[model samples]
Target: MLKPILIQINPLDNVAIVVNDHGLEKQTVIEEYQLTLVDDVPQGHKVLLKALKKDEAIIRYGEIIGYANADLEAGRWVNESVTRMPEAPELDKLELATRPAQPLESLTGFTFKGYKNKDGSVGTKNILGITTSVNCVEGIVDYVVKIIERELLSKYPNVDGVVGLNHLYGCGVAIDAPAAIVPIRTIHNLALNPNFGGEIMVVSLGCEKMQPERLLNMTAENKRIALADEDIIQLQDERHHGFESMVAHILTVAEQHLEKLNQRQRETVDASHLVVGMQCGGSDAFSGVTSNPAVGFATDLIVRCGGTVMFSEVTEVRDGIHLLTPRAANEDVAKDLIREMQWYDDYLTAGKVDRSANTTPGNKKGGLNNIVEKAMGSIAKSGTSSIVEVLSPGQRPSKKGLIFAATPSSDFICGTQQMASGITVQVFTTGRGTPYGLAAVPVIKMASRNNIANRWYDLIDISAGDIAVGKKTIEDVGWELFEMILRVASGEQQTWSDRWGIHNSLAVFNPAPVT
Candidate 1:
């Protein structure tokens, strides 16, 4: 039986959340109080348990989440309300306490099959990527990929695949502006990504916000590769000829790297070398019950092994950060985490976008009711590890541990930024299921429903639905998943994303201009 608790979030709050629903019937008496059923609150939804005057605060997880726009009463259902008042308390002033660190237990010397680069970074997979500077060159880059698929690659089994990254914004944006900088940095990150075997053939229009010369200059100082005679010759030729000829010549040169890449194999490396990114999309009630928690267990395993795991979708962590704050590495990291929360609050308010509107229409139909409840379940993927770092979108992790990346909750956009930040692989949990994938990294789909997994076995690599049906514990499923990660990293299997040919359909965060 589930126990529900009425959580009084703050002293100023007018309402409390039903945290535990102890399976008690309506009008049941407990702790000197007779509890009545409020509106039928779903797992990730809220119910108002008290009456409040207009402008009274609404609280959850012991923090102010929002305010009431109108008078509210007990037993009322709290849907997505547009009221955005009530800022979070300052982290420095908050009287929160930290938990003592547990004894460190690490996964022993487990290494994925990867390409060891000269710069000391190991790639989980090897790929030949045709990077574009702007949309104007998208056609040329795509054409080059067609040529690779048609003419080359059949002879090179080591080459994972060839991809072209095309974006809508790049030529018309202001140079060095957020819009331009985001894409430029993304491209730079992709080129430097270890998954590429330090081999990239960039295609550009010669004139764009990101110049081919500038892109080349950025990687000139990279220590990953020794200046080989063949690489030098190809670079000189590409610089002399225009874009079209350069694209052709680079395709020929790529064949050479592909031959060498095939001979590489997985070797024993430290588990600490692994960095895993956690994400979920198209969620349903079973998400938290099965796939999410199972992934959370895997996250715990990775962190326990001295590896780093990252969880993004900040908006979805609203109700869940409370459970995570106590694990913060230090006061400064905790403050940054809270500051990011506040920043999202202000950003939503300024744009007049209802924060509760965070849940997509599909999400509600799938059983979620509000952001707070949805957030609670979403954070289940982080496991019980302490958060060592809090990162902005596309920021790389400086330390090895569990991290929370502040990113928009959008699936494609967030997934793209995670890949750009050097995550070699993504563990994407889905109940409703999604087909999105990144250009530079592999995405492994974990399905939470047996029916969905059976129907779409081609798209799903792991079926965690067994958890929902009580056939497996999260720990059992997590070990299975950990083994899968190890195998995928060792190049023993192809991820669903790799098979479907889905790549380069997402980009980094760029704020929309205020009209």
Candidate 2:
């Protein structure tokens, strides 16, 4: 028989979450706390440790997560229905850089074998990315990509794979609108990712609003591609060409890029060349207790090794902005963090909804009462590193170390924006389980509960859940994850997502009006 376990995160906490996989039944006795369960608390759900009157504050993680709806007795289940979410922290009243992070010891001698680009960026994979100017060419691009995989991929064993960077933009209703820059720059930067090996090839329909030249010249901060006339293949050109001729031309141009990519070789580089993104979805209560904290530990290690790490999802960070501002490297970076939060707040207001909409049914069922509680847990992946910089959606980092990339909380959009910002690998934590992956980079999945890890044995990469069962310490899992990151980045190991080929389609965040 299994013993019932309850985990209290802080000395001030009035509630503790049920840790046993099957939960504890009513009348169950816990000798540690000298209390009996008044209700059947489900796994990951919280149980009150002290009786409270109506509207009393409910505390967890040493913070007020919510307020009781009515008088609540001790040992009772406290779920979303019984808890009223507190208001978000006031952004204007926040103190900037009040408690900056203490310096961490240096982590040196970590390296990975990666392909080096002439622009000074290192890539974990060498791929030929085929971009498109408009959605009209999407079908053709997809078609030709299949043929290339079948015919040409085998010829170049050095190239990892080919990706057709197709999206639902170009020739749309409001291409010149002020907000249009979001998707446009996103598509522009996507083609220049390190994995593409700087072999920029675009299949244009020739009549799209977003011209090939304009897209290529979107930015100069990153080394812009010197547009070659032959690199842009116009399917609508007045040549003696049918569908087969177009396919033949595309295949020829792709082969040229492949030949260049195949010539590149992997060389050992320090971990400073690595850019990692951390995110979570389908989260549960143990997220903060196990997986996220473990990820945070690894995040700190990456920063210590002089690598770049970014954690995003704007709404998820909104409530925790107060906690993060003090850790900023300086006042300017602190303001930059606040600016992104204010922008997202206005964006949400324009849509007539608030951050409360962020929590899903799965999240509530997993013991997250509301967005406030979820946000507190979500920011745990940032670790204790100082905030070195802040970035807008799709904007690449100017400096290294820990960065805050402002992006939506949706898993797909967040992943896409992170990739555009130039992340070569991602770590995703989940408790409810997700098969999410991206074709452009490798995704490592971490599970928060022993049950999920055991049930989905082959799907999960690292079992942070063992911390919850007292089988492993957070430091043990942290070092394990940090080592695994180097191996995966070096191509010495394959994540389950890549091994199973479970790549989700790219989802661009288009806040502008869609025509």
Give me the candidate number with maximum lDDT: 2
Model 2, residue 384: distance off in Å is: 0.2
lDDT of each: 0.68, 0.91
Candidate 1 accuracy as TM-score: 0.78
- Number of clashes in model 1? 11
Error of 1 at 127 (Å): 0.4
Cα distance off (Å), candidate 2, residue 30: 1.7
Candidate 2, which segments miss by more than 4 Å at Cα? 220-223
**Among these predicted structures, which one has the highest TM-score?**
2
For candidate 1, give the lDDT of residue 260: 73
Candidate 1 wrong stretches, greater than 4 Å: 1-97, 100-103, 178-180, 213-247, 259-263, 512-515
* Candidate 2: clashing residue pairs, number: 0
Models 1 onward score TM values of 0.78, 0.98
- RMSD (Cα, Å) of model 1: 5.9
